[model samples]
Target: MADNNNYRDTTHQSDLSISITPAKAGVGLLFAGGALTMHRILCLSALLMGLFSAVGVYAADAQQSEPVDPGIEGSAIDKSAKEKSDSGGSSFAVWESKYFASSPDNTGPAVEQPIEFPHFRHAGDHDKGGMEINCMYCHTYARRSLVAGIPPVQKCVGCHQSIESVRDKPRIKKLFEYWDAKKAIPWKKVHDLPDFVRFSHERHIQRFIFQLNRPVQEVCGYCHGDVKTMTVARRQKLLSMGFCVTCHEVKHPVTAEGGTPIGDQAYWYSMRKPIIDASGIIKAQGPNDCSVCHK
Candidate 1:
């Protein structure tokens, strides 16, 4: 009986040891699973933070790279408005000359014969042979002086002196006669600004030529229009006082149509209106202060 009881006690002890081993194994597995899940959560949080930081940096760089658009804020509105008021009447009339009479005496010889000079015809290109010279070669002072000078009889004679038998045209013959008589040719002024206004060829040329680095041909066209195509030069631009003021106020270096640079040509830099037509003739009103212009 003692032997059988000892055997039963040993068997019970073995069974208890087996059960404890399985419980220990399950607890170890649960702890490992919790640790792995925590590590994965931390890795995911770090990745999300890195992505957010990258996006923020990209946004800042984009803003800095953008270009600034200059608004039309610095304009002289008052001067412009006044110009519009003055030019409101007789928008089409050229210079208001005192000598101009509406009607001439019918009995008298036709005093002013219209010079039927076709600007387009002479400027056109022909298939057989034709060469066009720029207007500035003859009207050299247009870009450098306030008034574009008409070619003197001497200048015409420089070329005409050599050419013979081409005196059929009255204007050409008249030019030669003026040269022979040592008299100045009386060419009608086609475009004249008002007396009170001040305009500068030097300023425009300097800004466009020296500062902006524009070619002469392109710069001259701003006022003269395409002289290459015109036979008889007419007033191409309205050249109104308001037109001058508008250009001053907007402060664009070049007209928007041409991608020309206005650069330092902006009026504010000069501290005075550079161009004015105040005298009612193409009157330009520079800055209002006396010191602005006189000083």
Candidate 2:
């Protein structure tokens, strides 16, 4: 009886110990799970903060890079006054007259020797040769770079290597010598805009040719004139500030309805186009303040 009682006591103690062990393990597992969950929360919060900071930095950078718009009110008035001043009594003939002579002394019977480059003989449909090459072929850097670079003599000799049998072509032969010596030809600039104006061939070509779906030749013809027909180039137009402003005005004309001039309306309509409000109502923006261009 004593042995049986001892065995029963021992079995009861083992069962009690097993139940307590499970409870303790459950508590420990719950604590570990809570800690893991807290860590995940902290990591997620840090990730969100990092993303927010990055976005704020990008927004600030974008704002700094963007170009400031000068107001339209003063710009419109200035442009209007300029037009009136230019056209009030100034004759076109007077404007066309040369201000400076070729020589400083103004002597030698005014050697106004026109370079009569036979475009017909060089490029036109003649039996000898009529190479229908692109204008950018000669002015190679027109598309890719800021300045339209004039081709050196090496570019000419690439084709003239076989045509050495031509008669009395001293200029062509000189080009060969320059090519052999690897020297650049000194070509005079024909179309010279003021240094202040930031005119870029690349930007114009990218906009008109690539974006606006215009032909390259037609776009280039605006500034270069008919390059295909010209062997010796000349400035075809007087590219003045007024000229640019006039074109801008035409494209975005002022449309006033009341006694007060809708200067802001005209400005926005001209500056921002297809991206404007569908209702065609011009949103007021900064005026053509002096700092816009002068700066």
Candidate 3:
């Protein structure tokens, strides 16, 4: 006997469907008495043919109605939504800009920091008459630790002491007070993630910039926005689990539709390696398990 699992039923979304059963058709035909005219048999045959044709067409339409792609749709990124923003404008970029547009963290005009540290002054450019300081200089522990350690008051003092460029500024006055007090500067957290998720700056930085040797902007731009423009730091992306998952998949993407990484000459991706602390016993492999993040 044929397996029931192999049988295809085409009864979806139809009020009156054509179900063909060999035994029933045979029995119904057999019951036709000898009094039945030849025209009646021909008419019945035509009706059956039409029903079969309808079933075939219905099946075809069902398949085309929905598409399944193991490589594209299965990823954390939404393929259908992505297609909508493919034209010159980036869908992810568009979403990132407005993700926290109206939140408390985002002040419509500007972010009010304890000290009005201008990112544009430090990370901007020589053309803008800005110092264009390297981010790592202030965020020293970025590549080596989970939390990108904030620059201490002394870091600011060390420069302002001699530079005296903006020495008399009120914010600079606040900096000197903290230095004199011998206390940690109370900088507010900007990119605060949920307590459940464990993010590693070491792993990401090592992979993208160290291993791949990609540019700093591309590496930093992955999560932090274009800080060169903003005077105060603010979040650019949603920073949700889905956002992290989508980026991770895209970075080392092997199953993308084009069989290539989702990057272009205009903006390329950073490639980083996983560090395994095996107590000098074995190399550590980056985790892909639920407990790794949740715990």
Question: Which regions of candidate 2 are displaced past 4 Å?
Answer: 1-129, 164-168, 252-295
TM-score for each predicted model, relative to the true structure = 0.44, 0.46, 0.57
Rank ordering of all candidates by lDDT, starting from the highest: 3, 2, 1
**Candidate 2 lDDT over residue span 1-295, tens digit each:** 1111111111122233344444555554555555555787765655555555556545534433332223344344345434433443222223322321223332122122122334434544445465656557777788777788867667777777877575247666666666778877666676666566666678766766677766555667665545556566655544564444443432333333221335545344333321223465433322232233332
Looking at model 2, the pairs that clash are 70-287, 71-286, 71-287, 71-288, 72-287, 72-288
Q: For residues 1-295, what per-residue lDDT tens digits would candidate 3 score against the true structure? A: 0211111111111212122234444444454433255578665765565556555556644533343332332222244323323432342343335444555554233446788778888888789867778777898888999888899888888888997767788878888888888987778777888898888888888977788776665577677767777778877655776556555433333322222223443123222222223332221112333455665
Error of 3 at 281 (Å): 27
Off by over 4 Å in 1: 1-130, 165-167, 213-215, 252-295
Order the numbered candidates by TM-score, best leading.
Answer: 3, 2, 1
RMSD of candidate 1 to true structure, Å: 35.2
- Among these predicted structures, which one has the highest lDDT? 3
lDDT values, one for every candidate: 0.46, 0.47, 0.55
Best by TM-score: 3
By lDDT, the better pick of 1 and 3 is 3
